[model samples]
Target: MSVSHETRDGVAIVTLQNPPVNGLGLATRRGLVEALAHALADASVEAIVVTGGARAFSGGADIRELNRPESGMEPTLPTVIAAFENSSKPVVAAIEGLALGGGLELALGMHHRVAGSRAQIGLPEVKLGLLPGAGGTQRLPRAVGLETAVNMIISGAPVAAGKLAQSRLFDRVVDTDVVQAAIEVAKEAAASGELHKVRDWTVEHPEAAVFLASARTAVAAASAHYPAPLRCLDAIEAAVNLPFDQGIETERAAFADLIQTPESKALRHAFFSERAAGKIADVGADVAVREVKQVGVVGAGTMGAGISMNFLNAGIPVTLLETSQDALDRGLATIRRNYEGSAKKGKLTAEQVEQRMGLLTPTLEYADLKHADLIVEAVFEEYSVKESVFSQLDAVARPGAILASNTSTLDVDRIAAFTGRPQDVLGLHFFSPANVMKLLEVVRGKATAKDVLATVMALSKKIGKTAVVSGVCDGFIGNRMIEQYSRQAGFLLDEGALPQQIDRAMEAFGFAMGPFRMGDLAGNDIGWAIRKRRYVEKPHMTYSKTADLLCELGRYGQKTGAGWYDYRPGDRTAHPSQLVNELIERHSTDIGLVRRAISDGEIVERLVYALVNEGAQLLQEDIASKASDIDIVYLAGYGFPVWRGGPMFYADTVGLDKVVAAMRRYGKGHEGAAWEPAPLLLQLAEAGRTFNP
Candidate 1:
């Protein structure tokens, strides 16, 4: 049983037995109801005290059970709460570690709640695109004041019980044992003979209407399109206007409808996919991991400096190596400037910044990295540049040191082959502005050791990164899929679509920036270099010449202050460039291509479906172990819309059959070979299956 019953003195103690933040599944709910019934029937029982161990009161509903039919079976969370409400004996909640989502709602139902001062409490269902489906929306405001409950429910962030010690939600917030404190509260409640039902509590506010109106504007402005924040406010407002029963009905109705929304499904998928990305298919937790006490970074440019910040912030010392004293000084200065910028914003203290900066050892010598545990090469993104760096590391690095290449496109296996210890060499492909970004693509090479992979994965989490493992391949996962997306964006530009039109469509569809604006920000020279290589390696492939023309004109992006769009110095805003648009028209004419009016729908489909098709192919090739892994990469690294999920999940929601039809329709146009659906995508569509399911 997930619920255990025992009697201390004349009080019946009910403990939630499910381990690791006792989730309220069907069995747990059933056990709770049965225990309440048992306590009510007992002749000597004076009061009932409910508790989940010291680690957690409850984390909430068993997320694994959320999709199951049994989740809504007979003894639902509401039914168990009803049992407590109907009970003659006083029911008290002993909250220890955390009470979140349904867990907080459960605590709210008890006649009295006794919590440890350090316990975390909140209703965080909004993060899953939900309002608390139980009675949280109604009771929270009545238990705590209106503003506090509204803030907690809407933000979905935890608050310490100690902070809420003055709130009525907890009868006593103590430093001592919470269960024992609850027993005493239970005895007091039993003697008082008062049914302290939250439903009877008044949700009072002097300026209710004005407060709700202001909140609506704030939430709407915060997320212009997301429905949850506003929907949550709607439910909370119901608690203020209507009775508890009506408010609960409103919350339940909102939850039911929200679960069916595409936004909610996408949010739920993202939540699960991120957690799943940490686990490698073959490498178990039992795998041995190397200690990474000291880190060595080659190259002292923007990337090397950012990479060094991640380790220094994690309290690991780093030896930042550059070719010259001048370059090393510049890199060190850049790191300090970033830290100072953070301090100016009050995100870091001056002393804290110095503590992080102190961990760094800037050097011009490769021999200085001999004793380091891991050496990450963040030098220039060229084979020869990496080859020289790795050769020096192979010669100078200790016997057990792990060597990593921060190569975004270059093959990890070939990079590993340059070193004598192939097992210790792998690609740690960190996105640009490495410390700021959450995604870390861990590329596994042909001969990379299992322990080496495990160690890097662990270290990635320690440094606050979502690590997704990728098999050795050109561009690994994100870059490979993005290449196709970029190609489609170019094709759109050639077919009478302006850079602004294409970028606006993508941005409207949830991408952080349109391909053109992104190119301008990331530097147009980067794509030109890739296209330059593609011209020799993939001569048969078709690509728009407009981008090449833009780069050739010395418009290398923000660095040059011009590319697809013009930029003014000291302002990051991109202004439409007539020079670039005229160039696009000339290129289309030079290619003898007729410009057709392209719909925003067509632009979005072409760009996004291109990514979906390539991702499916990667899944088929085993370059990616799972579809969810690919989704994680895009969601984390790329600014794929969270509301739409990743491209793969979005495809499933759109219906694969429809996606294939769209691709087939696009195939009739230029570069038809690239638009052909992957065999795996076609197979799944025919079988009526989904990529993530």
Candidate 2:
């Protein structure tokens, strides 16, 4: 909804009244169009000021509508922008907070743009497998020139209002009520007779061709599987060469094309899936979050230090507790070096680094945790070792302090059961190099309090991390899926496919890195340790004999210069090892398995189906809230390509019935244990339903 009226001085003000992000949905779009039409109809009005509800000007097109094609609600952005550009009276955009995607396009249509102190603008359509279709491609180039426009659009990066003003995109930027400032600018522009069309503004960058060519190459390299970036480049090029109206038609055609694409559907699924992942089974929006001012970190190793870094970065004081001065000193030295290195790299200032360092108080005692409000343990993966840590933490940490474990593949329930305050115990599984990774799997044990989960979720955002709430299970969401993915890859290798062929297939399918390459990067010994642990716990559980053979040969990974692939010293390129190939051949012959050439299609389907099967199981068991949560984990943590959306989205494109038949066929050929389809997958497949549903 929006309000429109002619002011006393012949200036019309149009204010969007939608709450939250004010995403331009059907009603909001209709309201905007009507408001503009009313302003344009009034002969007394000399100029118009476009503003927003409260803080946020707009987030973008209402994402809900992106997938709801049957809504019959075309975004009013294109129509409103066309009217604004062709209006008789000057239209001034007054931006506050974020004006992103179609929101920026709306501003670009106006004769002048005035942004507030905290205003940010960008075209982030690429993130959602889209390019701006509402005159953004044509007008932005005219406003900011070609090079800067293409970079901003392709990267989907937001530029601050101050920075945008320097780019000469916005006519003026001020630290005042944007509406009033826009009104003043509107009056001056009207008086000066500056009511000219922005479309008439020529876009003549001397290096336009070079910039577009470079952008095409860069985008192709960065996004090999995704079509959105390439399509975005095409639209930008249309704006450069084609006339204004033709560019607009080109944009519309491109947008319509993307709307029908599987990539767009998948990406849209991911966007909603991340939002849905925050919803917990027992926890509601009304759940209260605890006030955590001070934090206690146990085991100051790599995980512990990185976890503590997040706390300090969030401006929370931390008490880093270790067993010995030598260990504590090493942790402290690593923390200092990390911060100093960041400062050297221009990521942080020396002053900021010093300030963060001041927040940390390292102690070689459990007693130091007494005053802490939240205590997180990042000790060894052994349950007994973790139990001991939790027992001491429960005794010393203040009442109401949340006890968290950074265990990637351990049972959260077992750890919580060992503690007296089980209700306050939960799992905070941070991905490797925790400080760098954005995904944090927040596992809820049987007794984890609602407030505890909320606090952790809020804290994840505070530290610039996306927390996916998961029900406690061995490996939780991510590792469990990876287990299946790894199995599929190993099976492919055991069959006729080489490591190089398997890696190339997966990477070509849009994965940033293949399982083998990823394994090498993280060290193969990690998986070996996990497998060894699992086999010890449950001897009946299935174990891959192939990985064990590789481990036995001391082929760890890139760190050891050998794994499935050989790593050249000082180089990251993973080449298929002849030694590994020979070993696999001998092992296959020993096991009475005949090697046969495998197609890339078979490799892709096997690995993808493995992930899809596990994802279905997770969803059925309520380990994950939705199929999208699994996708988010893979996309953010496991380098699953953003364009394919995630494993489940890919499954939908493949068709559930087909996946079920393939899994059944494979299961029959192998043992039932080898290629068993998840019951959920079977159920959905039988019903002819998709995982996305």
Candidate 3:
């Protein structure tokens, strides 16, 4: 049974028993209803207390059941809540840990609520591009007034029980043994013969008409790309204007509409994809993870310092190594500056700044990292530099210590070959500004042990990273797919679209920044250097010379205040450059090509489909375990819009058939070979299947 029923001295206790967070799945809902019925029918039981154990009351609805037929199963959350409302026996909710989304809605159905002070409460379905569908919208305003309910629902952030205690949501706030206190409350309420229902309460807003009108305007502006937030406002407005039952009906109708929207579908896909990314195909729960108590970092450059901060923030001590005292001092200063900045912004306490800095041991010797549990080399991205560091680590490091390379694009297997114990060597490729970005590509070398991969994957969570396992490949998952995306962006520049036009189109499609703007911010010289290497290695690979020309003219990017677009000193905004525009026009004329008008639709399709095609290729090669894993890599790491899901999910939504057809059309263009659809994409398209399916 998902719920257990017991009684003591005429007080019945019903406990929700789902592990983790007691999600309101079909079985759990059925169990709750059955338990409630049993309590009401029992002769010995006069009052009832419904509680979830120390972990959670219920986190909400089961995400796995979303959009599935089983979501509409009998004894739905609304039906179960109605049963609570109509019960003869007083039902008091004893909430601990969390009561969120449908979980809080369930608690609101009870006659009274008593919560542990530490318990968190909210209706947070908006994060999943949804409103609280199970009467949360209609009932929350009645419990916590209109404005507070609107802010909570729209933001999808939780409030602590202690904070909401005076809001009348909970009848009593207890610091200890919430269930026992709730049982006492239930017994008293039963004796009083009075049941308090949230539905019987009226939502009072003095300036209802003016406030809701202003709120609708604010919501529309803040949620321009999303439909759910606007719908959420409408539901809240109904709560203020209509009667209780009418407001509930309006909320249900709005929720049903938002659930079917494309934006909601994409958001839901991202939600599940993040959870799915953590599971390894071969690694079992029983796999032993190496203890990463102490971390050592080589090369105290920008990447090294950022990488070291992740461990330090997690309260792990770090030993930072550099070639010279000056380099070590500079790196340490940068780390301190970063922490101080966070402290200034109220993100960290001043004591936390010193605490993290105190953990760092900066040195110029390789011997200091010998006893380290895990050593990460964030040296230059050159083979010789990586070889020297790994060889030195192999000589001095303890036998079982894990050796990790923070190389974004180097061959992990080749780097592992430098160490004596290949089983302990792997890649921990962190994205730029490592402490901020959540994506960590855990690249698995051929000889890498299951425990090592499992350890890093598990450790990623400790460091607050979303780790995606990748097989040994040229660029791993994110950078490899991004190479194609960048190539297409370059091709678009050479064709007809200018830098700003391309960036604007992509931004309109919901990307935080367009390719040209992103390239400028990331330093265009970085890609120029990568291309210089590729020019020698893969001579047949085609690319636009526009970026190279920009680099030739000493426009390296924001560091130089110029690249595809110009930047003023101290401002990161990209302003249109007449020199860059003339450079692009001159390049087009020099190449004997006529620049034609390119539609924004064509630009968006080409750029996004480029990623989709490359992702399908990665799937074909088995570099990525699943399609959703690729989505997680892009969504978390590459600034792929969460509202569009990952490239794979977006492609599926666009229909694989349409994507393949677009690819075939693009294949006939100038750089035709690059646009040729991946075999997997073609196969899926022919079979009328989706990448996610």
Candidate 4:
């Protein structure tokens, strides 16, 4: 049984026993109700103390069970809460760790609640694109004031139990033995015969009408793309204005509506996908991970310094190497500046700044890396540069030390080949500004050992990253797919759409930035170099020369203050350049192509479907293990909007058949081979299957 019952001194102690996190799934809910019935049946049991063992009181509803048919099974959260509220015997909630979402609602249903001071408590359904369904909206407002309750419901961030002790949300905030305190409270309640129900209290504000109206306006403006926040505000308004029971019905009805929205579905998909991204099908739990204690980072450039910060923040000592003393000094200064900036922002203390900086050892010689358990080379993106670095690392590094390359787009196998031990080499592709970005693509080379892959994957979590394993391929999973997307963006430029138009359409579709804006921010010269290489590597690959012409004029993006858009000094804003527009027209004319107006809808579909089609190809080639893995990569790394899920999930929402049809239409206008739907997409479309399913 998920729940257990034991009576002590006329008080029935009902314990939720679900491990890890006590998710109130169907069995747990039913068990809770059954335990309650048993306690009420005995006249000797005058009161009940509900506790969720030593771990979490309850983390909330079982997210894995969400949307399943069994989720609505009898003794649902509402039914369970109703039992607690109506129980003849006083029910006291004993919260030890976390009481969140439905868990908090369960606590609110009880007559009394006693929590450990350190316990976390909240109704955080808004994060899952939901509002609380089981009387939380009504009762929370009654316990805490309308403003506090609304803020808690909207933000979905947990507050420590100690923070809410004065809010009447908790009957007692104890430093020790929460269940014992709850038992005492329940015993006292049983003796007093006074029923304290949150439902009986009135939700009041001095100027409730004014506050609620202002709140509704604010939420509507902030949550234009999301429907849940506005719905949450509406629920809170109902809590303040309507009767207790009517407010509950209002909240439930709103929840039922929001749960079915595409926004909610996307958020839920993102949540599950991130969790699934960490598990490798082939790498079992028993796979031994190499201990990564001392780490070495080569190249004291922007990428190198950021990579070093991740290890330092995790309390691992780092030996940062650069070819020149000046370079090494510059890198160390940047690292210190970054930490000092954090300290200034109140995110870190002065001692923490010094402590993290103290972990970094700047060196000019490669010999210092001999003791590193893992060495990540963040040198320039050149085959020759990488070859020299790896050859030297192979000679100087200790046996069994993992040699990793932080190459965004290069052959990991080729880098590994430079070293005698190919099994010890792999790619740890950290996105630019590595310390800030969460995605770490663990590129597994052909000869990479299982243990090495396991070690890197394990280390990824230690440093707080959502690691996705990728097979060695040109650009790996994210960039290879992004290349196609960028190609489509360039094609759109040739087809008569301006940069800002494409950006606005994509922003509307939920990309944080359009391709042009992103290119500008990341330095357009990077893509120029990649294209130059691609031109020699694959001569037949068609690409728009508009970008090359812009580069020819030295408009290399934000660093140069000009590219597809003009920028003033110190301002990153992209103002439309008439010169660039004329240049694009000239390029189109020179290529013997006529410019025509393009719709925003076409722009969104082409760019997004480009990612989806390439993602399907990656899945087919097994470069990516699963479709959701690709989604996680984009969601965590590429600024793909979380509310749209990822490209694959969005494709599923659009229906594979429709996506294929759109690709066919785009194929007629653009390069036909480039737009040819992937075989997997065609097969899935034919069978009416989704990538996720």
Residue-pair clashes per candidate, as listed? 0, 0, 0, 0
How far residue 432's Cα lies from its native spot in candidate 1, in Å, is 1.8
Give the alpha carbon lDDT tens digit for every residue of 12-111 in model 4. 9999998878899999999999999999999999999999976899998997877897688888899999999999999999999899999999999999
Order of models, best TM-score first: 3, 4, 1, 2
Give, for candidate 3, the lowest lDDT window spanning 10 residues: 488-497
Q: Which one is best on TM-score?
A: 3
For candidate 3, lDDT tens digit of each residue in 202-295? 8878998898889888988888878888888888888888898888998899988888888899998888888888888889899999898999
The residue ranges of model 3 lying beyond 4 angstroms of the native Cα positions read: none
> lDDT, candidate 2, residue 665?
72
Q: What TM-score should be assigned to candidate 3?
A: 0.98
TM-score computed on alpha carbons, candidate 1: 0.96
CA-lDDT, candidates in order = 0.91, 0.85, 0.91, 0.92
Better of 2 and 3 by TM-score: 3
- Please estimate how well model 2 matches the true structure, expressed as its whole-model Cα lDDT: 0.85
Candidate 4 Cα errors over 4 Å, as ranges? none
lDDT at residue 678 of model 2 (Cα atoms): 80
TM-scores of the models, in the order given: 0.96, 0.94, 0.98, 0.97
Better of 2 and 4 by lDDT: 4
> Model 2, range 605-636, lDDT digits (tens) per residue?
88888888988999999999888788899988
User: Considering lDDT, which of the candidate structures 2 and 3 is the better prediction for this target?
Assistant: 3
